[model samples]
Target: MPRKGMRSLCFSSPKTLAYAISRFPSPSRSTAASLTPRPSFNESMIQQTIAAAENMIVKWNPDTSSFAKVTSLFYEDRNEAMEFIKCVNGLQKAMHLMVTENSGSDNLVRSQNLMQIAMKRLQKEFYQILSTNRAHLDPESVSARSSRASTRSSTSDYEDDGTDDDIHAAGDCISEVEHVSVTAMENLRLIAEAMISSGYGKECIKIYTIIRKSIIDEGIYKLGVEKMSLHQINKMDWEVQEIKIKNWLDAVKIAVKTLFNGERILCDHVFAASESMRESCFAEISKDGANLLFGFPELIAKSKKSPEKMFRSLDMYTAISENWPEIEFIFSFESTSAVRSQALASLIKLTESVRTMLTDFETLVQKDSSKSPVAGGGIHHLTYYVMNYLTCLADYSNILADIITDSTPPSKLHLPESYFETTDSDDTPAPALTIHLAWLLLVLLCKLDGKAKHYKDVSLSYLFLANNLQHVISKVRTSNLQYILGDEWITKNEATVRQFAANYERLGWSHVYSSLPENPTAVIPPGKAKDLFKKFNSIFEETYRKQSGWVVPDSKLRDEIKISIERKLVPIYREFYDTHRVTLGAERNLGLVVRYAPEDVGNYLSDLFYGTGSSESTSLSSSTSSSNRRQSRSR
Candidate 1:
C-alpha cells in the first residue's frame, strides 16, 4: 500500500501505471523531451521540509510567539532556540532548492517570506542573548575561555586514548565560567553563520560592532584615557602633563593587554564563520579607542622640548614599545591600519623629542657661564646638576639604546677616541646612549675647566678641578652608570684626579719646600741656621694662611689631599726642624725664629683643607705663646 499522504497518486489500473511510466522518456530522447523537467520524489520531500520549517518558524516568530515576548529564547530555553536555528537553516536550503527548480514557483515566494520572518526572529534572539549575557561574554572572560579551549584541544589530541574517561577528564577541565562563555560564543557563532549565509551579514555586523564598541570605549574611559589635541597638551604645565602621562601609561597597558586584546578574541569567536567579518567587526569596535589611546604620546612629543620632560617622554615610549607585539597583531587588519600608524607615529615622535631634549641638555651644560668660581674649591653647581641628570638617564639605557641607536655626539664637539673605551671583555662598541652620556660629561668637564680659571690662585684652580671631577666619578661608580661607563673610564679618570691633586700640591706649597736646606744633616754656621729658620717661618705662615680657606667637599678626597700634603711636606719639614733646632737654641727670641716644633707640623697640616681661615690666626698665636713660655722656663 502507498503511504497515507501519497495514496492519491496511486492508480487502480495496470494500464494507467504503464502509460504514466511511458510518458517519462528515456535518457536517449530528443533535446526537447530531455529538457522537459519531470517531478521527482525530492519535490514532495522539499515541500514536506518547508512545511515542517514553517511550523517551527511561525511558532517562535518574535512578533507572534508569547514565549519569546516574556523570556529570552536563547537564555531561558536554549533547546527551543536551537530548534529555531535548525528550522531557519532548513528553510534556507528549501528556498534554495525551490529557486533552482522553478524560478517563479509559488513555493519559492512563500519560502522567501518565511525566511524573512525567521531571520527577524533570529535577529531578536541574537540581540537578546548578547545583551543578557554581557557579563559572560565580556572580552576578558571570553579571551580567557578561548585560550583555555585552545590549550585543552591541543592537550586532548595528545592525551586522549579515545576512552570515555579521557573525554570526561577533558570535559571536566572547563570551569563554570568557561562553560557559560563557550555556550554564549557557540550560540552567537551559529546565529551569525545562519544570518551571514542568508545574506544578512550587515545586520549582524551592525549589532556586534555597536555593543562591543561601546564596551571598549567605556573600558578606555574607565582606564582614564582622554583625547586631547596637541595645543591642549602643549599648554599644560609639566606638573599637569606629568599626571596625564602617568594616567596614559596605566591606561595603555589595560587598553592593549585586556581591553583591545579581549575584544579581538571575542570578535573572532563570534564571527568565526567569516574571516572578513571578524576583522571588520574587530576594527570597527577597537580602532577609535586605540587611536585615541596611542595618539596621546605624539601630542606630548610635539610639546615644548625641555630637559625635565625627557623621562616622561621615554616613559610613554616604553609603554608603547612593550605592547607593540600585541598592537601589531590586534590591529593587523587593513581597516585598523590607522591605529598601528598612530602608535608608530607616537613612538617616532617620542624618539625625536628624546633626542632633542638630550641635545638641549648638553647645550645647557656647555653654555653654563657662571664666571665666579665655587667657593673653597668645592663641587660646582653644574657638576651636581649634570651628574644627577645623567644618573637618572642611565636607568632607561635599554629603551634609550633603541631610541638613539644611530645617534652621535654633535659634530662640533670633538671627543678623544679613548673617551669611548670600555673594558677589554666588552668588545661591543659602547651603545649610542653610552657615547652620548660620556660626551655630556666631557662637555661638563670642559665647562668646569673654563670655570676653574676664574680663581686668582693657580693652585686653587687645580684643587677645584680635582673636587668636581671626583664628584663626577663618584656618581658614575655608585649608580647604573657603572655598567654603562665601564671600569676603564673610572680608572683613567681617577688617575686624572690624582694628577690634579699632585699639581695642586706642587704649585701651592713650592715656596715652603724651597725654604728648607738641601741636606738637613749638614753642620752649618749659627748665622746661616738663623737665616734658614727665619726664611722657613716666613714662608710657612704665608702659605698656611693662604691655603686654610680652601675646601674639599668630599670626605675621602679631603682626607686624601691632607695625607698627601703631609707625606711630602711633613717629613722634610720635621727633619729640617730637628736637625737645626739646637743651632738656633742660644739665639735671642728663639721662639720667634724656630716657632714650629716637629709635632706641630702635622697639627697645622691637618687643618689645611677645612676651609676655616679665621681659626688659623688664633691657632698660630696660641702656639707662639706656649713656645715662648717653654723657652723662658728653660732660660
Candidate 2:
C-alpha cells in the first residue's frame, strides 16, 4: 500500500483498516506474550491507564498544562524521567508489533488504532520534555544521569524494556535542539539575501542597521550618547574606528555577494570616512565655504586679511587633495589603477566646482559692466582673483593630465606635435583635456573681453580688450597651462591683438581720407584749398576730441597704435598738401593755410590716447590747434 493510503486506513472503517493491516506481514502473538504478559484489566481500566499515562507525559504544545510542568518534575525525579522515556519507547514498539500480529482481525485492528494514537502523542510529549531539559543539561550531565537511570532500572525489580539503539536515538534528539540565537541569525541572513537579490537597496539598509546593532552589542563600537565617553581620541581613535569599519565591511561584502550574486562591493567605508574627515576640515576653514564656492566678491573683499578669506577656503580644497593619498591608501588592497582613477576623477570634480564659482563671479562682473564703467579696481581685482585661482590649478597638473588622457578618444589621441609645446624632440603626444581647459580659460577671458565693448569710447573699448587679452596670455604663459596651449596658440592670439590695433587705426584714420575727396585731376578749384583745409581741420578735431579721454595703460601698445595710424595717414595727407599748394599761391600763405606738415600730423596723432596731456590741453578743437601751428613752424 502507498504511505498515504495506509495513513488513511487509520481513520477509515474497521474493515478497511483490517484489510490494509493484513497486506503487511504478521508476527506471532505467542512470542510477544512470552516477552510480556497481557493485562488482566477490563477495557475501561485499560482506557483509564492510557489517560493517566497521557497526563503524566508533558505535551510540548503551548495550549496544554504539561508545557509548564516539566522543569520541576525533571529536577525532582531524574530517574523517573528516564523511565517515562523507556515507557514511550515501548509504546512505539508495541504499535509496530500490533500491526504485524493482528493483521486479519477487526477487533485487533480497532485496538491497534487506539494504540497508534497513544504512541504518536507519547513520542511528541517525550521529545518536548527532552528539548526543554537539554538547555540545562551538559553532555557529561546527560550521560551520567542516563547511566545511573539504566543501572537503577536493571538492578531494581523493573525490567529493561528498550534496546541500546532506542536509548541512543532519544539522546540524539535531545542533543540536536538548536540555540535560539543561532536560529535567529540564520533567518536574518536568508532574508537579507532575498532582499538584496531583488535590488532592494533601501531595504538592505535594515541589514546595515542590524549589523551596526550587532557591532554595538559586541562592543566593537561604543555608544557615544553619554557626555563623558571613553572611546579613543585623535589618531588612535581613527585607527580604532577604521578597524571596526573594516570588520563591518567584510561582513557587508559577504552580504552583498549573497544578495547580488557575486557583484563586487566597493569599499565605500573608505570613501565615506574620508568624506567625513574632509567635511570637518572644510567646516573649520569656512562655515560659509559653500557661498565662497560660488564666488562672493563682497565676502572676499570685506575680509580684512591681506589676500582674502576666499583664497584660504580655496587652499583648503587643495590641501585636502594634496593629502588625499592618505585617504586613498585606505583602499590599498584594491588595484592601483582603479584607486588612482577614482582619486583623479574626484579631483577633477572638485576643480570644476571651484571653477564654477569663478564662472558665477564672471557672470556677476559681466552684469555689473552694463551698469558701470570698466575702470573700477573692484572689477580688476576680481578678475585677478580668477586668474590667481587658475594659476593654482597648475599644482595638480599630473592628476589633470591623467584625467585628460583617460577621457580622450583613441583615434585622435596623438595630436600634431605643433599643437602642444614640449621640451623634448618633436614626437606628437596624446592630446589631453588640458587643451579643453585652455579653451575654457579663453572663453572666460572672452566674456570679459566682450563686456569691455560696453564702454562708450571706441578707443577705451580696444584698450580694455587689449589689457584683458594680454593678461590672459601672460597668466597662461607663467602657468603649466602654457604647455597645454602651446606656443602656436599664443602666436595666433598675439596676431589677433595686432589685428585689433589695425582695426582701431582704420576706425580713427578712415575719416582723414574721407575729408580729402579723390583729387585725381591734380588741380584745385578757386578758394577750394581753404575750404578743403577747413574740412580737414573739422574731422581731425572731432576724432581727437572723442579719443582724448581714452586710456591705454601699456605705453608700448599706445606708441605702436599711434605709429600704425600715422603710417596710413601721413603719406596721404602729404600728397594732398603738395597737390593743393601748386594750384594755390606758392609762398604767399602756403605754410599758413596748409597748417600741418607730415611731422606735425604725426606728433598730433601721438597725443590721441590718454596721458598725452591734461584733459583741456588734449582737446584738438581748442588747445591742440595752436600747439599744432607752433609745431608746424618748427617742422
Candidate 3:
C-alpha cells in the first residue's frame, strides 16, 4: 500500500510506469485497515474527480480542442489553465487511491487514459506558452526580472502549488513586461511539474532544449561570433584578422553577460523540480556555442606570433580573464566543464603568445643593425619606433602584469635594482610590466650606443646619445609609463642626458676654451696680445663652422647648450677685447685682426646647433645684427 498523502508514483518513463505499478506493494492486514478511505472518501468522489479531469483535459487537448485551434490555452485563458492544472492534480490523487484499492478495475484504467490526455494538453500548453512569449521570456528580460525578483524573494525558491499566488504576489511590484514574464514562467513551471510527476520528463526536456538551443544559437550568430578553423585564421591577412579579433572582443561580453546568463536563469526556473534536468538542459543548449566562442582566442594564439599581433592577443586574454568569475558561475555544472576548460585554454595560449612576442620584440631591438648614424645626431628612427610602441604597450600594463609576472629578464642583460624602483614605494619591486618596459628601453639604449660608434667625431656620438635619451625620457613622462616607472626613473634618466651633454660640451669645445688665456684681464705686451687674438680668431672660426652643423632637436636642451657656451666664452672674450682694442688701435688691419666682438661671439653661439652650417659671411652678418641688438640693450 502507498503511504498516506503520497501524490503519485514517479517513473523514469512511460514504459517503466506500468512495470512500477505492477510491483506496487500489497497491504498487510494492519496496514490495510489504516489505508481505508474516510467517510468523505468514496467511490462517488473518485468517479466525480476522474470525470471532471477528463472533460477539462480533453477539451483543451491540442488534437481535439476547438478552442486550442483559435487561441493558446495558457495565454487566452490563464484561469482555465490554472483550473486545468488543478484537474490534473486531482486526477493523480484519485488515480493513486483507485490503484491501491484495485489495480485491475475499469475506473483505474479510465484514470490512466485521462492522465495521458492531461499530459498531452500540458505538453501542448508548455510549447504554446514558450513559443508565444519569446519576447517576454527572452534571456535578457528574464535575467533582469529574475535579478529584481531575487532581491525580495529567491528565484530558486519558486514552488508550483497549482495556483496564481506567485504571480499575484509579484503583480504590484513589477512592470507590465516583468508581469508577463512572471506569468509565463509560472505557467511553464506548473506544466513542467505536472508532466515530470506523471512520468513524461523526457518529453518536457526535449521541447525545452529544442526551443532554447535555437534561441541561443541565433543569439550567438547575431552577436557576430563565427566558427573558424586554425588554418583559416593562420592564412588570413593580419588586417582582416584584426577586425575579427575586435569583433570577438565586443561580442564576447554580450554573449557571456546577457545571452548565456538569461538562458541559465530560464533553465533553472523551468526545471526547478529536478536539479539534474536543469544542469542537463543548460549544458545541452549552451555548451557548443560557448566552446566555439572561447576557442577563438586559442586559434588566434596559435596563429603566427608577431610583435604587432601581441596587443590584440592580450585583448582577447583580458576579455576572458575579466569575465571568468561569471563564466564559472553560469556554466558551473560538471556537464559544462568543457566551456570552462576552453576559456582557460585560450587565456593560457594568449599568455604564451604574448610572452613569446615580448621576447621577439626584445631580440629585434638588440639585433637592429642600422649602422648609419642619424645625419645631424638627432633622434634615430629606431628610437622613435620603439618608444612609441612601448608607450602604447604601457596602456595595457595591468593586463600585461598577469602575463609577465613570472618572466624575468635574461640573465645576460643584468638590469640594475634601481631601474625597478617606483615613486610610491622604493622597497617594493616594480610591477613586471615596468621592469619589462625598462628592460626593452635598456636594450634600445645599448643598441643606440653601438650605433653611436659609427660617427667619425666622438663628440657628435655623445650628442646623438643625449638627443635620443631625451626623446625616450620625454615619451615616458608624457604617457602611461610615468605612473608605471615613476619619478625616480625619470630623474635618473634625465641625469644621464645631462651627463652626455656635459661630455659633448667638454670634448667638443676644448679647443675654443684653450684658445683663451687662463686670465682674460692679465697685463701683456700689445704685440703678444695681437698674436693671441689672431690665434683665437682662427680656432673659434674653425670650431664654430664644424659645430653649427651638429643638431640638438630638443628646444629646451638646445637653449641650455647655447646658454652654457655663452656663459663660458662670451664675458671673458669681451673683457679681453675691451682691454686690447685701444693698444692695437693705430695698427694697420686692426679690423681684420679683432675679427669678432664679444656680442658677436654671443650671436654665433646662438647659431651653433641649427645643423645648417651657413656661409661664414652670412653667419657674421646675422651675428652683427644680433650683436647690435645686444649693444642697444646694454645702452
**Top-TM-score structure, candidate number:** 3
Q: Give one digit per residue, the lDDT tens place, for model 3 in 187-246.
A: 787787667656677789889998989899888888888999999988899999999999
> Total backbone clashes of model 3?
0
Worst 10 residues of 3 by lDDT: 151-160
Task: Name the best candidate (by lDDT).
Answer: 3
Q: Which portions of model 1 miss their true places by more than 4 Å?
A: 1-44, 102-104, 151-171, 413-431, 525-538, 582-597, 607-618, 621-635
Model 3, stretches more than 4 Å misplaced?
A: 1-19, 22-40, 151-171, 413-434, 587-591, 608-619, 622-624, 627-635
Count of backbone clashes, every candidate in sequence: 0, 0, 0
Would you estimate the TM-scores of all the predictions?
A: 0.82, 0.39, 0.87
Instruction: Measure candidate 1: CA RMSD.
Output: 9.9
Q: Tens digit of lDDT per residue, candidate 2, span 60-160?
A: 22235554434433334435544544343333334334444543434344444443443334333333333443332222232333333321111111244
Candidates ranked by lDDT: 3, 1, 2
Clashing pairs in 3: none
How much lDDT does candidate 2 score?
0.45
The residue-by-residue lDDT of candidate 1 on 396-462, one tens digit each, is: 9899889888666554445456555546777676667777777788888888888999999999999
C-alpha lDDT score of every prediction, in listed order: 0.77, 0.45, 0.80
